[model samples]
Target: MLPFTYALRNLFRDPARLLQTVGGAALVVLLLIAAVALNEGMNSVLENSGSTKNVILMGKGSEESIERSEVPLSAESAVATSVRGLQEVLGVSAVSGEIFYQAPLHIAQGKESQALLRGVLENALLVHRSVQLIDGRFPQSGEVMVGHLAHRKLGVAEEDLAVGESLYFGDTELKIAGRFIAPGTVLESEVWFDRNDLAVLTQRDSLSSVTVRMDAAEFEDVEVFTLQRNDLELAAISEQGYYDKLSTFYEPIKVMTWVTAALVAAGALFGGLNTLYAAFAARIREMATLQSIGFTRKALFVSLIQESLLATLTGTLVAFILGYFILDGLAVPFSIGTFTLTLTPSVIGVGLITGVLLGTIGTLPPAIRCLAPSLPSALRSS
Candidate 1:
């Protein structure tokens, strides 16, 4: 076994070369961490949106998107009456009919943005517990309730959100009466309005979806009855399942992560190999001295590999510290979702393993080259 100080000293012998190798490995680890964090962040967004006790009913032909589904208003009433095991809080049973629309909104700040519009009845807040009032008042007939992210992006403050302040969307101008927050869900990026007002404005009389709450223990019976109705053609699914299906919308992202990782690794591997070869090139006399002292070829090779591994481990530690603080809390927006990068335990593990493997694999060929010659031959060349 080599002393820890020996490996440490060997790496720092050529400060420039050591830094290059470490920096290359560090950059690869950083890219890997960032990629995995995105997937985890997206998963968190969807998982938080899902509730085990809630069920979503959409038109039969629609696979995942509520925006594409159009359920007749009469179906909501029929499902409510026939569905057994429906949970009720207070006197009202836990069922709500809702509509979804997307439109280009002209910000009062002189910027044009497209936002998803969700039209809800009075019990929306009660059914979705995450919805909380942060300011002003609830929506009146012609008013809108803005989400936190919407407020931030649209530059609409609570003071600016008065009962009669008009916002132009296409040919319509809706008033802003309140602001709400629903944490850890895509709802935070939407604007809520009265269903009747939205339907009139959008020229759609039908609802988009219906949500019902039932006892988790009785989910089996409720699911069977809800889907087996002879007159209604609809699909009923757990809210969790519905959100999980939404992952398909971002499927390209997972593939993109792997592709980026592979590219970074290829670059890192080449850079690491070059640095290790340069380090060995400079230490030709040192290898000759080791051979003269009866240190076997295998020992010399192992020492070089260990030296490379030490340098990479240092970089990985630095990257972990930097990535957790600098990369986390970064919010990136897209048409379908907004994600904040996060480094979970699994992500960190992957980064570390990648760095170490790059170090070991990059050093092997150079280490073998350094050990192949006779002591007199290597010494005579320098």
Candidate 2:
């Protein structure tokens, strides 16, 4: 058996090969961490965006996109009165009739970008219990409030959307009255306006959707209301159900991301294997000499694995360091809103597992081929 120091010392014999092995493993592990983090972040944000206690009432056949759904302005009051057992805060019904729109918003000194707009009355805070005002106050008529992460979606400097700043919605200039945050939810990437103000700006009288918070009531109760009131032409879906549907809607994108990571990982795997092949082939004669002195082939194989693991583990550590600084808490903007990428425990576990696989599996083909030669054939010629 070879001493552990023997394997460790051999790694420095060829600096370039060691670097290649380390870099390849780092790239593969980084990609795995990023891909998993991306999918998880997106899914987490979408899941958190909805609550079990809430139901969305929208126009039938428009459940896929709330922006396309329109409910009569009367439905807001009607649901508050009709849906018994709905949540109540200070005697006010926990109902929010909102107008959802996505349009280019112009910042004074920044570029125009498409931003999610949600028009809601003050009662929206009651329904969306996650929302908390971090600065200033709720928006009033002719004013708006920006979410803490809205600047990421708006493609502007954070100061551009700061309280006291103004944004242009088409030809109308709206003041930034405040900033709020809904942690882990897509709502943090939206701009909220007074319902009447947005209706006037978009020139629509109908509400996009009406959201209600349930207490003693259940989803079936909300569904029954929609079914019983055929005149409203509305559909009822639990908020959680709605976002779950949305997650599937973006499934193809996630699949594409996975495919891309797989391809890159495949490339890195082959590249690392090639590096190991070259590095190990040069040591065949040394291995043969060791065997002649009674070092078993199995022992030499274990030594090679140890060396490979050292390089790969080193690379894994580097990847995690870089990911922590670059990927963690990073805001990533998507169609609905921006989600934050984080280095959760699950992401770290994925990275460590990937590194181990690369160290073990990726080393097998090259290691076996290097040690496969007959003893006499290998010893005679160099």
Q: Cα RMSD to native, each candidate? A: 3.0, 0.8
Candidate 2 residue lDDT tens string, 216-307: 99989889999889999999999999999999999999999889999999999998887888888888898899999999999999999999
User: How many clashes in each candidate?
Assistant: 0, 0
Against the reference, the lDDT scores of all candidates come to 0.77, 0.93
The residue pairs found clashing in candidate 1 are none
Off by over 4 Å in 1: 1-3, 151-166, 216-231
Judge candidate 1 against the unseen true structure and give its global Cα lDDT, from 0 to 1. Answer: 0.77
Question: Which candidate leads the pack in lDDT?
Answer: 2
Candidate 1 local Cα displacement, residue 131, angstroms: 2.6
Candidate 1 lDDT, 222-321, residue by residue in tens: 5676567745567778888888887776778778877988797678878778767777877777888877777777777777778888888888987898
